[model samples]
Target: MNSGTKQHPWSRYVALGDSFTEGIGDPEPASLGGYRGWADRIAEVLSAGTDDFAYANLAVRGKVLRQIVDEQIEPVLSLRPNLITISAGGNDVIRPRSDPDEVAVRCEAAIERLKRDNATIVLFTGPDLGFSPVFRGVRGRIAIYNENLRAIAVRQECVVADLWALTEIQDPRMWAPDRLHLNALGHHAVARSVLSALNVANVLQAYDPEPMPDGTWRGARTDDLVWARTYLAPWLLRRARRQSSGDNLLPKRPTALSLNGPRA
Candidate 1:
């Protein structure tokens, strides 16, 4: 796990986003409940003990950009994280009343607030929802969202993770049965992408892109993956399957289940 260079272990990281940041499709779901996620993985790679640094994942499912600003962003400022990673905007895209321009503005404001604390910020854009049949007609909107995110990253001097491009080249197995959420492999891909962007060491050193158990899709089965399925994937699949079968399990929205953004 060595990077052939001296690097100080990160002492604190505050992760902000939705379900994707929560590792929704990881194999074993129980492990991801508390502070577990890519941010936790990165923290472990950089440091030896949990007390050495605090990694907090302040993400919740079905949270839009405004919600993150109110809930996660404001409270985390007090932690004074040495590093921060935000994976947001998916819910904003999927919601029926989503205004892309307002989302961009909110995102920009969030980034600015983070900058005031002077932590190394990594801002991840939404993945390519276009690849899924559910999001078939809104590829253009996804693209515009990503473009605005990139602009904000540039303006605010934040590192950007090109999640859209990374997911675009992947096969179907990378996504969960619901197709909107990332499977185990997709989560690893996202972790690696973020690590590479930050020049972090040993984060993905032992990464293996394999599928989960129960004859599921293709991807890696890291601890994070195990956590994802046990907790997050089952409900997602149930909802998706129910919706596909014309069952009204959840609230009715303007878009199909597949078009529900990045499972976040």
Candidate 2:
């Protein structure tokens, strides 16, 4: 997907956050951690024509906002990247009784720390999930968080990849089977958005969704039952046990490296 040939100004880029940044839904067996997400795709474009460019991804699945700031921030400082993209707090906002305002405060603190080096920062607004069956209840909370991010980006003078406004994400075809994460198509759309926000030219193009399968009302209900039984139940159980998908996992790319060989 590294189609850009023009020289971009960024020499170093680092991605930070949770599953979304880690490229969970878009699996790649050849990639580190079996994922090649939007961050990796963007890296390919950014690395083009830049001989000294390096990229690192510190995102892990199931990481909360506090963990991301407390754990990943220090490593980012050490990397001293000229460009950074962070998408955190989605895991927090979805929790019961979680306060979007409080989450935003923590996020702003992280933003303040990252700004110290005067690097170009890109922030993401969570995608609108109102169209999702399982996540529709949390749509309001996500919206509030998205607004906070928009304000933070303006105040911090950071670039924004506004996923809330990315209408393509609302389509069910753009998501993975889990419904919580984006599929390959969704990740591609996000990569495009990030490139647009950064004003970097790339040859990435839009992809059409596969044709929807015909279904009856009973079939839809049956699918919902299967989804809940498979994904939702397990996720709830994990929360009850205070378990995480990233419990024993490490960052796919813990340090900046050349994007010259492999994909992720």
Candidate 3:
């Protein structure tokens, strides 16, 4: 930790990644682009302090690490941010043919570039997918991916959010209706995690999610059918067509600007 880091807020904070960083599932009607995920939450808090803070979020949903590197790494460096975060590769690792070693190397490379630019790189270990029935097949791969992230953080001196360690998020309520993304409460927990890692005090507490429907076996089966009909089927169709949810989407904040204070 730098002596002056606490004395001054980050002048420029750039966030780069995929849907997780893009604030999916946690929709905020008032927020720009109708999303308010962890990065936005943290940025809001940072901007509330006495020191000025400029923030930019360039994350889009469904991005892989290579695509992030190809499309974003240079842009983030160009912004010359004091703090930058890179959280991606979830989409990549889940593929049937993914190579863990290659993905790890790519992640490390991204961190190395951030270090070269002299930014405090904050990385995230993907959340444990074992809790999701549909994602169970990739649980082993995700474990390996999380392991790689921890090792990379140790070697690169980057902060890892360690989402897998947060038992609070394992609950069904932490997930969105689709069971693929996090709901508002889950995003809040992740924001708290990131804030804690940055040694920032978070007044934005993680709260109990809104009450859910029946959790009994019969209820579960009913809900599962609903989910498949509502979300999972459409998602699979999109994947079959090689269309991304973010194909036409743009970053919520394409340029850095002073956050001034928390959004109401």
The models' CA-based lDDT, in order, is 0.63, 0.88, 0.82
lDDT, residue 87, candidate 2: 96
Model 3 C-alpha lDDT per residue in residues 157-222, reported as the tens digit of each score: 888888888888888888888888998888888888988888876556556445355488988899
Q: TM-scores of all models?
A: 0.73, 0.93, 0.91
Q: Which ten residues in a row have the lowest lDDT in candidate 2?
A: 206-215
Instruction: Say which prediction, candidate 1 or candidate 3, comes out ahead on lDDT.
Output: 3
Off by over 4 Å in 3: 1-9, 208-217
Q: Candidate 1, which ten residues in sequence have the lowest lDDT sum? A: 253-262
Over the stretch 154-224, how does candidate 1's per-residue lDDT look in tens digits? 89989898887784325666766555567667776677677778786442532355654444335333534
Rank by lDDT (best first): 2, 3, 1
Displacement of the residue 38 alpha carbon in candidate 3, Å? 0.9
Best by TM-score: 2
- Model 1 accuracy (lDDT, Cα): 0.63
Candidate 3 — worst ten consecutive residues by lDDT sum? 1-10
- Residue ranges of candidate 2 with Cα displaced over 4 Å: 1-4, 208-222, 261-264
